[model samples]
Structure formats: C-alpha cells, structure tokens
Target: MQIPEYQLFVHPSDRNELRKNIWQDDPITAKLTIGKKKYAIDLAYRGSHIRDLRKKSYRVTFSKPSMFRGAKEVHWNAEFKDPSLLRNKLSFDFFEEIGCLSPKARFISLKMNGKNEGLYLELESVDEYFLGNRKLPNGAIFYAVDGDANFSLMSDLDNKVKESLLVGYEKKYGSEQDEVHLQELIFMINTLPQEQFETEIVKYINVEQYLRWLAGVVFTQNFDGFVHNYALYRNGETGLFEMIPWDYDATWGRDVDGEIMEEDYLRIQGFNTLTARILAIKTFRTHYKNLLEDILTNKFTVDYLKPKIQELHDLIRPYMQQDPYVKENLNVFDHEPAFICTYIEARGNYIRSQLDVLE
Candidate 1:
C-alpha cells in the first residue's frame, strides 16, 4: 500500500490512449505504452522524472497544478507504511454500498506490466469553485482524489462560502492569512445548527441523502475522514455544493491501538475540540437515528452489508495473516461496531444537553 520509490505522469495527450489499453483484455508494460497506446499515470509534479505510481491514487493527484510539489513528494516516504492496496479498495467498495454512495463513481481494474495493477475508483469530472475564488475559469474540469470524510466536509463548507458570497458578506478578518483555512472550514460547517446548512444542502443538492451517508460512515467506524481525501463541486446553474469521498486507506479496521473507543468515534465526529464543528446532541440524534434506522430497518438494512463485509473478510484474510501491521490491528474489527454504537448513544445523550443549553 505504500508508494513506489519513483512516480511520473503520462503526458496529457497520452492519457486517452493509456485508458484504452488499460481497459483492454491485456495491457503491456508502462514503458511500451505511448501517449496513444498507454500514457503514464504519475503522481509527481511537473519536471520530476521519477514516476512513483505509488500503491494509491495520490500518485495521480499530487501532480496537479494546485498544490506544492515538495510537500506532496515528501509524503511518498510514508507511503509504504500503509496497509495493502487491496484492503483499501475493498473497504471503499464496502462503504460505497453501505452508504449507498453515488453511483456516478466506480471501481475499475487496470493492468500494467503484464500484471493486475489493482483497482482505480474513477469519479466523474467536477467543476472547481475554489479556483473561481481566485478568479479561475468557471467550468474547468478537475479529477477528485481524497478521502470520504474530507469530501463530505468540503461539500458543506463550499455551500457556506457560496452562500456567504451570495449574501454580500465582506471578507472576514484574517481569512486570507490563515494557512490552514481549509481545515478550519470543516469546523465552520460542523458547528452550524442542523437547520442552518442541512436544509439548504438538501434543497441545493440532496443534503438529506448526504446526512444519511455520513451517518452510515459513522456506523462503519471511519475515523480518518479528513479534508484531503475528497473532491468538491458546485452546481453549474444553482451553484450549490456537493462532495465525493476518496483516499480510503486508513479506514475499515485500522485504528491506532486497535480500539474503536467512543472517544475516538466522537473525535472523528468533530467532538472534544475547542471548535464549532461539534453538533448539538438533538441535532446529531435527529439526523443519524432516523437515517440509521431507515437504512437498517428497510430493505437496505445491514443485511446488504453482510456480503460486502464478508467479501472484505475473505479478501483481506490472507493478507491479515501475513501482514504484521494488519495482524497487530486485528482487534479493530471486533471493537468497531461497539465503538460506533457507543458513540451513537453518547450523541443521543448530548442532544438532550444541547436542548437544555438552548432553554
């Protein structure tokens, strides 16, 4: 699951041909493929010859013009410390069904160097609103590469930013100077009352469904849902925001210390922080309870997850038996649901306290 020692990108003109070859019955080595037959899919920034083609998608992402190449390249050193690539893919697929995630994205298999190159979850192109904030083009297409939690937070934050601009709000103090403003944006969105952004989000672009999606994620014990592993979008006409999840390497059963404690779950849910992302107990309960029950009691109940979970169990079993990292983290599977359920119960209790505070 770690990045390779080197990474490089296929020329833009060569990408289409590379895609075709990858989709074909057989694919040759990465070198034999040309711009037309097989373009490279590198994760390096401009001018870096080493194409890491790491075990994950960041290899394609860091090469983009948006972020600094140095910082991106530095992360490669830590790539190999990650879990098996197959594990990450299965985890993502499981949540895709568990959360009933968007059907627009899909996990596709590719071949390289005459061997299975693993799976890539390709998402449809999305327009970038942040670039517009810097006066970039309006409808430019950008490929998403990030994690699910981060993606969800981006959708919510972008909505708030668009709304603020629409309402004629002036630039806030020090907004531009903040180096980690993107991280702060998550805090802003999480603190909003359920009624504030929740309804607007639903009306703008199926926010209700997204809330249900988030609830499902909580149930799955995903604690690494940060802002990096996601993509952001705004409606071309309505300008409402939307999100898609990405970079699911640290999810499923990979918790530190191999325990999915209630504290850990709340921390992931944006609690125990001196920030605004914390939700009132009632707000959290009203949204997640009904959503969890709806999905659990309905035909889309936990039963739908059985096959996928079993698939994951089977797929990773061999690796788990061999991988020392996975072996050390094995207890994570046993504690995941208990952590989720306990966290959900705590949120229920907090909802009443939040109501009391309101009174």
Candidate 2:
C-alpha cells in the first residue's frame, strides 16, 4: 500500500512554542506538504495523556478553510498505544457500516522538518465541512471534552449543581441560538418527570440515531465514550440532536493505555445520565436491544470481522516494522488480528447472553 506522505516545515521558535504547553490547543505558524501540494498551516500538539509519549499526536489547521481534503483542520495521531494501530479506523468504519455519521480515517507517513516521524493515523475533522461532505443540513457541532458531558444536572468537576447547562461541551460549530438549544436539551433531560421524559425526549433527540450510536459504543466496549470521546450534532433540518463517535483509539478489547481489557468491562446498557433516562423507557430500550442483536448476528462476528482485521493488519505490517512504537510492541502487533478476532468471538457470546438484561 502506498500511504500518503505528510511533511511539515516549522521554524525552531514556533516548534519551541508548541512544546511549551502540551495541554493547550495553542498553535504556532507552520507549513505542510502533501503530495507536491503545500498548505499554510497552524500546527499544535493534541491529545490528553498521550502527549507524554515519545511519538506525539498533532492537530493541523489550514489557513484556507476546506483546502485539505475538504477539511480546514485534521488530526494526525502517533497511535503509539495501539498494538495493531487499527482500532480507531476500525471503529469508525464499523460506525459507518451501522448507518452512523463518522469521520473518515487513513494511515499516512509523516515527516517533520525533513525528519521521518514514522506512521500516523490521519483523521478527518468533524465540523461544518464534515456535514457538508455528507450533504447533511447545516447544524451545530459540540465536542464532549471530558466526563462532565454525561448529561447530568450535577457537575462532575465538583459534584455540586452545575453553574451552566453547557458546562462540559465545547461548541465547535454553532450560533448563539444553537448554544441555547444545547442548554435547553440538558435542562429538559435533568428536569423532566419519568412519563414526560419518555414521551417528550424524542422531540429533542433523534432516538434512532442515539440508539445506533449507543449500540456502536457498547459493542466496541469503549468505556470512556459514553461520557466523553464523542460529539453532538444538532441537525438543523429535524431540530433533533444526534451523537458522533470520536477519539476511539481506546476501543476493541483494549483500554486507553493499550492494556488488555475485560470482555465484560462495561455493561450492555452503558453508564451515563442521558443513557439511563433513555433506557428507562421500554420502547427505546427494546429498539436498542434489537440493534445490538442485529449487529452481533452480522457485523460483530469473528468470521466477518477477522478478514477486515487481517486486511488492515497486513496493510500496515510492513510499515509497522518502521515505526519505533510499533517496533517496541512488535510481538503484540503481529498477534493483534488473532487477538481481536478472539475478542469478537468472546464479546459476541457475552453480549448475546446478556440480551435479556436489556428488558
């Protein structure tokens, strides 16, 4: 496979500025080249704890909006933690298969100032351009940056009453009116009575979309995704909010640290304030159960997923030997496809066994 080459040219002073604050999204001036085309870009280091790794992740913003593959901004992750380095891409593809709107992903070779940076996973940014690419109606997008986005009235940061209804979400694309809609949705979720919430929640959220997204997270066993590592897209056409998956590197039988996670690590229902209320209603709960059942019978099977896993593994294996991070986990890297297939078999059986609990 001929992976795309992404080369960045940054002044030493700007490079020093980016390393100053790893936690902030501050960017310095830079330029990037991709396939003989160069773009004026603002580059910044990205990720939470992954910043500590030798190989770092990056967020690149083009000076010209939608210039790079119809995206003004993009993320290039070192993927240092994943042995197979396929979890994020695999999860996104799985979400797309399940009829959910998800970011497109690919592997690329990266160079910084003429120095080889090995392999990186390039992710399409989820924003106005993302919806435009899908030809969806104009809408607002928000990122659930932390655990506080669990749709709870109480603040996860303090365990007290939240100061604002929009405490946890960072509005990536929205107007002043869109912000008001988010606040209203959070307020309604927290204040409504049982009967009213079940009957009326549908007006605020697309139940089918939410359920499908929930099923994706549950099946992949992304423990942190229920609260964070996702996005909210409020569709302008339907006036209903929908969920989008994000930062999925920590999925597929592994934790964020790339540790071996338990097959039953998370319950089928998934834990979160919004999910609790939605599953409390039997009709929505049954619909969710059916989605899971359909997925297990078709999408989440060992026979079906094994080929895809192997294909991705094979495509990246030759390149894997070149990545320092992949070299460190070479043994684990080679066995990932088999391990993932095993995980699918076990996870499918476990989910099938727990179908009754959804009732």
Candidate 3:
C-alpha cells in the first residue's frame, strides 16, 4: 500500500529507534505535521499486524499529533490499530443512516511505508461554554468523554449537575446516594409533570431522540447505555439537555450466544414480553413507556439499522465457518424477530394505558 506521507516532526530518540528498527513491541513512531500544526505521534496496534508490516501490535490506536509553536489547530495522523476500529467506524456511519445528532469523527484510508493504514477520526476541541458575556468554567456543568474521565469547566461534581439531575432529591442524593442509578434517575424525572420533568431530562436525551437511541441499544445489545457513555449537554440557551451516544466498542454481536436466536435481543436487554411486563408492573409505567418508545421509533429502527444487524450476521456467518471463536456459534443474529415481536406487544400495551396522556 502506498503511504499517505503525512508531514511530521519526529523526536530524535523515536526517529533513531525507527531507523534502527529497535522498537519491536511498539515500532513506527514519528511526529506528523498537518497544515500548520504538529502533534505527538505514536504507533498504534490493532488485531495483530499492520496490513503490511510482519510484526503485530494490537491494543492501541497509533497517531501523531501536530506539534507546532503557538499552533492553535490540532491535527493527528496515525495508523488504525484499535481492536474496535471496524465497530467504531460502523457506529459513526450508523449515525448517517439514522439522523445524526451527535459529533462524530470522519474516517479516511491512508497508507504508510507500503503498509495499509486507516485514519481513524478527528474532532474539533470544544472549549468551555460561554455564559452570557462571561465565561463560566465553574459550574456543576461537566462533560465526560468516557466513564473514566470528566472534563469540567468547574472544580468537581459539585451540586450543579446534582441539582439539575437530582432535582427535589438533593438532600437525599449525593456521592453517598446509592439508589439513584441512571434508570432510577429517569424514573424520578418521569414523576414530574411532563412539562416540568422534560425541562431536565430533555437536557440529556429528549423523548423522541431517546426512543431512537433505545432502539439502537436494544438492537446492538449495547448494555452500557448508562449516563456516562450517553451524556446530556445542557444548552444554556435552550435550557434543554440533548442526548449524545459515544464509546461504542462493545457491540456488533460479539458477546452473544450463537444458539440463542436473534428474536430475543430485546429480551436480553430487559424488554422481552414477559420480563417487560413483570418489570413494568413492578417499576414505573411511564419510564418503561418512554424507554420502549425511543427504541422502537428511532429512524435507525428501519434504515441502516435492520440492515446493519443483518450485516453482523453476515460477518459472523463467514467467521463461524472456521474461526474457533464462532465455530459453534452460528445463530448469533436470530434475535431480531423475537425482539420485534416482544417489544411491539409490550410497548403496544404500555401505550394503550397512556392513550389519554399521549393524545
């Protein structure tokens, strides 16, 4: 493969190591320049080997960040070696089939040193939000990339977010609060009049968009659809929370039982007919209704979604031919029918009870 020849600034030690081929475990390092900026560069490993390199490095996504003096634009060039590259690309593209509502990185194919590489993604840095004429870096407002890190204009997870999310329950909610998981938080918010409660929940995942997200989650078997992965950006202007999904490295039917059949995907996510009813009767009705609505009606529900699920089956079907990982697991994508049946029935009944409210 022809290399893209991305401009770079190389560290002397890294350049020396590459020249000597001494860095076996993590070889291929360089400082790459893009436009007028330079970024730190490092070799990323995915799967086993680069498309051409005989050596195998899997576990990291390699990239060189543009590093230039007083450079404001940040650019990175690197090899796509992350184990989850395919799924990440699919997730970004999935938004295209569904009306994309969140920020996504653009992917481009590149080559280096006769090795085939993939350009993963690039994102514009988002600075602190401006409030009125002043900049507010000290509010309960915070943004988290993943579950592990939190980016805040403020100091900590003080009362700001707690106040917004845990309204009316602050005295009982805190770091010491254990009962309020994301589900319960949604339940609590549902308790308020739709107009009042929506004021807060809308800041994260609105009623319509959330339904689509739920459908994606159910279809993809994305169990980690908690608050951390999908976050709420409080638009200070609209005072509405917008839901955005991120960090989708665990889907694509990788962890499902092949013999289980695809019809039960929703059941696995706790939306099956039997479990759905048991949970609804035991839990809040409105909450379950909201959750089911978002999943069943999202645009992706029909667009690339069904086709994507079918593609997953196609990808696994070939692998099952010989790969030991899926050799005995052939029925990985059969849960679709069962989930559709169960969700429709369960959600239909729930909606009937709310005809007055919905209309």
Candidate 4:
C-alpha cells in the first residue's frame, strides 16, 4: 500500500535552529507540501529519547493553528524503537474499540529537504479540534507529562508531599479556572472519606470512561500510561473530567527499549491513586470487573487480534524493508505479528485469571 507523502522545506537557518534546540519545544518556521497543496507551518523535533535516534519524530503545527482535515497539529512519530511499528497505532485502535477516547493514526512517508525519512505513524493531536470533530462539548485538556501526575498527594519520585496538586500536568487548553478544577478533583481523590468519595467522585469524573481507559491500560500493559501518558479533559457540559490515552508505543509485550515484558507485568487493578479510589467502591469495581471480562472474552483474545495484527504487519512490511534504521533487524520486524499474537493469548489468560481480584 502506498502511504501519503509529506514534503517539508525548511530553510538552512531554521534547520540549524531546530537541530540546536534539541530538548526545547520551540518550533521553527517551515513549508509543507502535501498532494499538490502547500501549507506554511511551524515544525519542531519532538520526543525525549526519540530525538537522539537517527530516525527522529516531529511535531507539526499549522502556522495559524488552523484545522487541516480536523487536526490543528500532527505528531509524526518515527516509532523507531518498536520492531513491529504497529504497537502505537494498534493500541490507539484498541482503545477506541473498547469505548475510550483515543487519537487517530495512520502511516505516512516523510521527506525533509528532499531526503527520505521513511515510514512514520502520523498521530492526531488531542485538542480543541479533536473535540470539535467528535461533536463533543468543549472541554479543558491537560497532558500528564511526568510521574507526578499519579493523582496522589505525595510525589511518586521523592515520596514527599506535593507542592501543588497539579504537579505533572501541562495545561494544553482552557484557562486557570480549569486548572483549579483539576486541582480540586485531585484533592478530592486523596482527601475524601471512603463512602463520601465513592458517592461524590462521579460528580468530578466520568467514572465509566475512567474505568474503560483503566481497562485499556490494564490490557495493553502500558507501564507509563497510568501516571504520565494520558490526557485529563474536563467536560464543559457534564462538569466532570474524562480520560484519554496517549504515547502508547512502548506496549504490547514490549518495554520502552523494545525488550520483552512478561504478559502479567501489570495488574488488573492498575497503578495510581485515582484508580485505587475508584476500585475501592464495590459498584465501580464490579463494573470494572465486567468491563475487563467482556474485553478479555471478546477484544483482547488472540483470535480477535491475530488478523488485525497480521494486516498491520503486512501493510508495513514493504515500508519496513526500506526503513533506514532496520537493515540488520528486518527479521525481528517481520516476526512481530506472531510475537504480538502470542502476547495477546498470554495476556488475555493472565487478565482472566486476575479478574476475580476486582471482587
């Protein structure tokens, strides 16, 4: 299959500026050409460890932050560390199937100054545009950028009282009032009495959505997802927060460095203070237990995912053969479908065994 091509034309000075600003998120002016159309844009190198890779990732924003096919910005991830190159997209698709808000993604080919950058997964940015497209009411979005976003009163790293309730979240949309609302929710999660917390927590959060997201994380076993790889959105209409998944490349039987991770590495309860509180309530725990069982019986099984895995793997095989970073490890990439299938079978059985713990 032929993937869409994006041509980036960065002036020499802008290219130098972008290269020098490796860790900075500052974007430099550029021109992007896509299918006979040209758009002025601000482009920046994205990701932490990925910035050091030969095949790098990028964040592209329209110059005016205007919509381009329902997206104001796009994340072009090299997905270099993932041998399958399908984990991120697969995880996103899985979340959507299990009834959670997730970013949409597709494969693309990129060229910078006429240099081939090979295959990339183009991910949609979760912002105002994202909500508008879904016809959902406008909401505030905060990205959980670090371990401090574990919804706890104490710091995960230092184990000390947090200086503020909103330590690790980056406010991407909405005003200071929205930030205050988030702080209030986090405070309630940590402070309220058990019965009051169980009854009132639903007022501050969309509990069903949270449980669905929790189940997705539990199934995929995205180690970073519980704390730092999600978006907290405060719904304008409901006056409650909802969950969205992000940055899921390090999942599906692999660790961050692409090493093998056992299927049962993560637990069904998942980690984080908010999840613990939600599960502490008998009703919520029963709902979550049912959600996990339903998903395990239907969605997370090897039979259900094997064809999907093969389809994605086969679709990317041609591109994988030409990817600049995988000349020697092509075999590893080719075998990833079977590897993922094995993982699904093992992971499903593991979760099935652990479901009663939710009782």
Candidate 2 wrongly placed segments (more than 4 Å) = 64-66
Q: Where does candidate 1 have its weakest 10-residue lDDT segment?
A: 165-174
Give Cα distance to truth, residue 156, candidate 1, Å: 16
Candidates in order have lDDT scores of 0.37, 0.89, 0.38, 0.90
Model 4 stretches with alpha carbons more than 4 Å out: none
Off-target runs (Cα >4 Å) in candidate 1 are 1-87, 98-206, 256-264, 267-285, 298-303, 312-359
Q: Which pairs of residues collide in model 4?
A: none
lDDT of 1 at 122: 37
What 10-residue stretch in candidate 4 is worst by lDDT?
A: 63-72
Q: Score residue 23 of candidate 3 by CA lDDT.
A: 36
**Number of the top-ranking candidate, with lDDT as the measure:** 4
Candidate 4, residues 91-120, lDDT tens digits: the string is 999999999999999999788899877889
Displacement of residue 115 (Cα, Å) in model 4 is: 1.3
Better of 2 and 3 by TM-score: 2
Expressed as tens digits, the lDDT of each residue in 172-291 for candidate 2 is 999999999999999899889997988799899998999999999988999999879999999999999999999998888989889998899889989888899999999999999999
lDDT of 1 by residue, 1-359 (tens): 22111223344445455444332322222232322443332332211111233333323332233333212221221112233333344445545555533323333333433454443443322224243333433422222322223323323334433322112111211223221333343344545565575343333343544454454445444454433334433334443334444444444434432333442343324321211222343454456555555544442323454455455445444444443324565565444444434544453344333333322
Better of 2 and 4 by lDDT: 4
Per-prediction CA RMSD (Å): 12.1, 1.3, 11.5, 1.3
Kindly provide the TM-score of model 1 when superposed on the true structure, using C-alpha atoms: 0.45
